[model samples]
Target: MSAPKVLVVLTSHDKLGDTGKPTGWYLSEFAHPYDVLNSASVSLTVASPRGGLSPVDPSSIDAAKDDSISTNFINSPSTKPLFEQTLPLSDFVGNPSAIAPFAAIFFPGGHGPMFDLATDPQSQQLIREFWDAGKVVAAVCHGPAALVNVKLADGSHLLKGRKVTGFTNEEEDMVQLSKFMPFMLEDKLKEAVGPEGAFEKAPSAWGEKVVVDAEGRLITGQNPASATGVGKAILKAISS
Candidate 1:
């Protein structure tokens, strides 16, 4: 069989919070998974809601260049080509019939996701399509915030009965930026989704926590640190 095709979605936000300060994609969010998936020969595509030149966090890139995975992803001739090209969001708009091109959809997280993905109607629709298609739908950190508004055609939550985890409230609090965040993601998820609906998480910073609700083909990671774990989980789902 052909290599599994995976679509990696990212945030194109060029600014952080209300302060309008500059910001970019978190490194580990993309680098870690990009390497793991690339080595597996998965056909990968990177797209952002706003598209065009997904920004790499300055710190992440600096730190990654020294790390094994990051250095490999950057120096490898094959993966390096993606760093130069990215698909535009306009290509995904209202193309439900075209959604079948991918075997799975993965979203990497960073504060930037809170800026655009948290409420984009198109991104929500795309996610619904993935879930409906019975393909893997995975997100990490703030990437799960994008699920807050995704609903299937039947009006049920896309994640209604699925056990999933994301950046926890304690993690946010630890970052010392919880108060300034646009919304408490963990709280809103519990309130809207419910007690039995969500999964458990460990108390750790950038810990490797990933939840895969066997019934729904939905997977989630707790933070940037869970990127590789999340990628491995998605690979399992795709192969299954």
Candidate 2:
């Protein structure tokens, strides 16, 4: 049998809410999870909305000071090319055959996700397909924003009846970008999940929080600090 394949989706978006500041995928959000998955013999395909070189949030890389794993992922020769050569989302969305090989998908977040992935129609479709195929769907930080708009065959929101978490309202407040994002991620998540799907949050903004709802094909993390937990959950689901 072939190695377990995973699709690691990244955000190509830059520019944080017209502030002209650069914002893109958080390095550790992708790096930590990727390292864990890689060690598990998972092969990852990196894809982004715009393709080509996906931008890394400068602040994210800088903040990963104590995290050598993330630092190594950014600077290591083996991982450098993967980060630079992201396939376009259209490549997968335009050709179903191209997306057929993956057993699971992961979305790693930075503020950029709030700008694009949250409403990308193609992303919504891909996510629905993966869910219906009984594959694992996981995200961290602002990543869950992408799931808020996904709908299933029965015409119900994907997040409905599921328990999940993402970058909370307080986190946004702490960063002072709550007003800048296109939509409040927490509010959108709550709206999508409905009463049946409880959208809960971590008590603290930077807490390590993750939730796995097998029936919903969902795994989510509260913030960047939760990325490793999200990765472990994805690996557990895949292994199980």
Candidate 3:
């Protein structure tokens, strides 16, 4: 059988809201998951709302410096190019067949996604296509922001009544970047999923947490610490 193809979407936004600080996709969130899935022979296609070069959050680089996989993802010739020249998300919009070959879609997060992916109509439509096609949909950290605005063909929120998790409010507070964020990830996820939907979190800030709503074909990781787990979960879900 052919290997499963997964679409990995990154953020094109590089600036933190009003802080004048740089922010893009978190290094560990993308690197750990990429390493996990790539090692398992999964084919990954990287894309972004604006395409072209996808920026790496500067803070994540410093934070993930000690992580060998993250370090290698940056220095490795093969992986570096994936994010360096991402396909434009617009390529998949209005073309269901363009995304049909992929078995799953993943969104790796940073504050940048909170600004762009969260509200990008193209990103929302792409995600809806994946969901409507019965494909796996996954995200980590602030990546779930992308789903908050996604609606099904029936006009219901895609996340409605699905179990999910993302960067917690406590974690955001710990980072001291809560004020800069447009909305709290935890709250938005809870709201999107609605009353029946459960939004879970780790025991403590930054703890690893991964949630797989199998029925929904959705997987989510709470923080960067959960990135590898999310990837493993996606691999399992797709392979099954």
Give the number of the best model, judged by lDDT.
3
Estimate the Cα RMSD of every predicted model relative to the unseen true structure. 2.1, 1.3, 0.9
User: In model 3, which runs have C-alpha deviations exceeding 4 angstroms?
Assistant: none
Q: How big is the positional error of residue 90 in model 2, measured in Å on the Cα after superposition?
A: 1.5
Q: After superposition, how far is residue 3 of candidate 1 from its true place, in Å?
A: 1.2
lDDT of 2: 0.88
- Which 10 successive residues of model 2 have the least lDDT summed? 90-99
Minimum summed lDDT over a 10-residue window in model 1 is located at 80-89
Candidate 3 lDDT, tens digit per residue, 1-240?
A: 899999999999999999899999999999988888899999999999999999999999999889999999988998888999999998998898899889999999999999999999999999999988899999999999999999989999988999999999999999899999999999999999899999999888889999999663899999999999998999999888
Q: Candidate 1 on 97-206: residue-level lDDT in tens?
A: 66677888888887777778878887888888777778889988888888888888999877676677888888889978786678987776666566558756766566
If ranked by TM-score, best first, what sequence of candidates would result? 3, 2, 1
Name the better of 1 and 3 by TM-score: 3
Using TM-score as the measure, the top candidate is 3
Each model's lDDT? 0.77, 0.88, 0.93
